[model samples]
Target: MSSKCIVYGYMFLNVKMSSLLKRALFNNSQSIRKTAALFCNATRNHWNYQYQPGPYPKTPEERAAAAKKYGMTVEEYTPYPEDMGYGDYPKLPDIGEDSKDPHYPYDNPELKRNFNEPLHATAEIFGGDRCDISIRRRFSLLHQWTWFLGTLGGFALLMVFLEDYKIGRPVTAKQIPGQGVHYLFSPN
Candidate 1:
């Protein structure tokens, strides 16, 4: 009789737990669907390119209408230069010989001498023997060691505060009920 009663009690608890779990799952699924719909709508509305018609205007009136709609003044459209096809290639500026530097004379004897010398020898003309300078450390070794120790101590303290020690283990009298020293080393 006691065994039958125990079985019936377990069956009732199972049905109740299953109903609660089903309700929770159904509510979570509905909330997720709502969140997804909101995100999709937000993404669609955020970018102007998603709603824009086309790259170029279909007709001459369409271009004028767009400019007028935006409250911008319309400039007269001029045909591209005859030499340039579709205006893809830009016209190169005509750089004349007069644009050369007057300080660095092309015909000067000193300029010719320096030009013929090896690249390594040219570095002597400047103050340094090497072209590139060595990088100096900003902080001293003592400062770096202090920073490392400080960061290590901070992380250790944070770990001690954040984690719960008595999650899976049985409670102890010396553990002070709620507060206990959670050591990093676990026996198991």
Candidate 2:
């Protein structure tokens, strides 16, 4: 085959391989992957897991064993709370922090944080403050009516303007002297 044809064939094979790789990576069906998994744990975060939930073994007999199995103990492990929904779970601790958020440098005040300075750092400062629009509406009653009437009036005027022009065959006909008289409409 020509050099061009050989290059085209290679390109086609590469495309096919890439597509197959993509299908294997991002396929909707997870049964094959789940079955293929040798072991499922919180660390791997597979769809099917058979992990022992906690009150974390933060200080296990072998801390390394806990670290290897659970990953950072309370620091990073996301317990399988699926059993909690079914009311068959252990008394899990108040779990919230995932350690993913950037640590605030308390020591260095000069360095501005890359994150936006939150409106309320510790608590919802504006939680108690409420504005009830029903009691006192933002727009006055007069203003509301004026706005509604203006839009409606403008629409009505445009409709009347459309009615001003009449487009159809003329009701009366002009006569050609040589030809017979013509009527645009037959007598009723």
Candidate 3:
């Protein structure tokens, strides 16, 4: 080809062949799978779009619409991170009284305030919020220390147990440290 097209300022290809490479690869205007819209959909404020909330509610009507959409009163409604850009906010479904609904274990203000108690059975293994609670009873600083030190100590203990063998060693047991000579003051 004579010229190369750079789509969305990312694709800078030196095209020399004539194939589907001409119509498909250069721009998001034509292709079905690799579209330019997906790559160009960067949020104004956040890097990761899936993890962040919408950038709506710039006005009172927007807030009322959002509150109504979530089936909550305007006073009771809480927006996540409040106004960044237009996001398809997840609809808040009613989880009922027992808190067994599928939506209950997801991130929400109520779950943050309420889920202080340890999760059990299915709840412990299933949801991100449930496992993330990680109360002091189930997880602790001591646990973290034990996890780290246990691995190091266990490896060291294995090495200490194995280093005494004469299979591949050049020294005798009497020449080994602590076997015959004292470490504090040992004269050869």
* Best candidate according to TM-score: 3
Instruction: For candidate 2, write residues 119-186 as lDDT tens digits.
Output: 12212322223322224457899999999999999999989998978789877775566676553685
What TM-score, to 2 decimals, does candidate 2 have? Answer: 0.21
Candidate lDDT (C-alpha), each: 0.51, 0.49, 0.52
**Backbone clashes, each candidate:** 0, 0, 2
Candidate 1, residues 1-188, lDDT tens digits: the string is 69999999999999999998788778688876776798877566656542332234446676566445433334633222444442211222222223324466545433332332222222344323322233234798799999999999999998999787545766666644355665568788
Q: Judging by lDDT, tell me the better candidate of 1 and 2.
A: 1
RMSD after Cα superposition, model 2: 16.1
lDDT of 1: 0.51
- What TM-score does each of the candidates earn? 0.19, 0.21, 0.31
Question: Any runs in candidate 1 off by more than 4 Å, and if so which?
Answer: 1-23, 26-55, 76-188
Write one digit per residue (lDDT tens) for candidate 3, span 7-125: 52334333433445666566554574545556776643466543344455768888787666645678876564434333424333333223444454545544332432322223434
Please state the error at residue 77 of candidate 3 in Å: 1.4
Q: Candidate 2: lDDT of 82?
A: 49
Q: What ordering of candidates by TM-score runs from best to worst?
A: 3, 2, 1
List the pairs of residues colliding in candidate 1. none
Model 2 pairs in collision:
none
